[model samples]
Target: MPYKAGHPCFESGCAKIIPHGQKYCDEHKKMHPEEIRNSSTRGYSSRWRRESKIFLKAHPLCAICEKNGRYTKATVVDHIKPHRGDQELFWDRDNWQALCKPCHDRKTWTEDKCPVYHY
Candidate 1:
């Protein structure tokens, strides 16, 4: 019997048919060279990077500086809760704050230093 749409042509397959271009289904179509490489990686994809650039452009001024009445340009997205061991917290959008390069570096350096060992 001929395979129908949403029916797999081969055994152990589960994909719908695409009449035009590639015959592979939606999921299979996404497995193409560019899409395969793009889907294989995780976190902060190129699209995310582009979105960040757009965000910086939209809100050029630092959100913190604005709150403090400083009006400085934003340059970094900082995590409120530092991700020491858990990488998941590293990209928590809700836990992020926008800071200028200077402020972000200062905060990061401060966190890196051993307060107990330093005078």
Candidate 2:
């Protein structure tokens, strides 16, 4: 069987083919240099860890999985909107949602086509 086609580069109008596991093709990946950064440098630091722990405690079930009638434990606190470098949006609790790892990855793959860069 022939291999299935891969996804287009996440960069807008970029026709470069890339694997599902990657966000961008080699050329465009340079434009998204922050993608290679460590989690702590991307605002997932000690403060975020502490706050996300509290968030998960308050909302122990994945919102999407719960909506679909499965009771998955929420381990990730996702920003409903990509906060990018916006400090205000990053800290907005109203823009947050509780999600399991699978649910969070699915949402990111489908919805967050643009990667969020922490400045």
Candidate 3:
């Protein structure tokens, strides 16, 4: 059989080869434990869905759109400040706002800077 292919280590400037279906090799994994946990464990759950639905009902209009006078309907409950797996902040109503998917995506891309781009 041919040899299995692998990718370079995710660590910046590291050339260590690691198997596929992983974000980092064993060596660099320790430095990024935060990336190990899946999204549900990070805070989102069934309860979050229910609460977000209720929140959307109560705040039907998108906060960002309302500010811009567009009156678009809200389809997502966005945390004004990132909770970053903090349960208290995750459940904090004061830190939540209703947003359309587009505005939420834009805010997340601009503010959170997740999936940091290479170029």
Candidate 4:
């Protein structure tokens, strides 16, 4: 017989009932816990790191340091708006700034304890 939309079970011999419009019974199509969980937990892969590295290499001097007359090498990217929950600011290149090691360290320390990044 053809599959029925309103049928409770796929077939009389099936032990478990199937949902309307489904071809297979529950036991036949049920997904494992690991399969379902792993699919959702997938994260960003290596491509993102490669792009960021390329950007840093092309512009190697700290923007802040360069502007302030210090020529420290920029090794880290700083997000004007942090990537905690503000998703809109994630890839905003205009909001990115390069910082030297000591300056970056001081900025992070100030951010952890103070209200703003000081020059």
Best by TM-score: 3
**Between candidates 1 and 2, the lDDT winner:** 2
Backbone-clash count (model 3): 0
Stretches of candidate 3 above 4 Å error? 1-5, 9-11, 114-119
Clashing residue pairs in candidate 2 are: none
Tell me the tens digit of each residue's lDDT in model 1 across 1-119. 87544534221265454554344555665444332233215345676577567767766887767888898988877666664434467556676677899888887788744322211
Whose lDDT is higher: candidate 3's or candidate 4's? 3
TM-scores for candidates 1 onward, in order: 0.47, 0.70, 0.76, 0.50
lDDT string, candidate 4, 1-119, tens digits: 88655545444476565557565555644432222233223322365456557768878999878988889888877776544324456566776777777877787677633223222
- C-alpha-based local distance difference test score of model 1: 0.60
Worst 10 contiguous positions by lDDT, candidate 4: 31-40
lDDT of 3: 0.87
Clashes of 1: 0
- Quote model 4's TM-score: 0.50
RMSD value for candidate 2 = 6.0
Write model 3 residue lDDT over 63-95, tens digit each, in one string.
Answer: 999999899999999999887767888999999
RMSD of each: 15.9, 6.0, 5.1, 17.1
State the displacement of the C-alpha of residue 40, model 3, in Å, after optimal TM-score superposition. Answer: 1.9
Against the reference, the lDDT scores of all candidates come to 0.60, 0.87, 0.87, 0.60
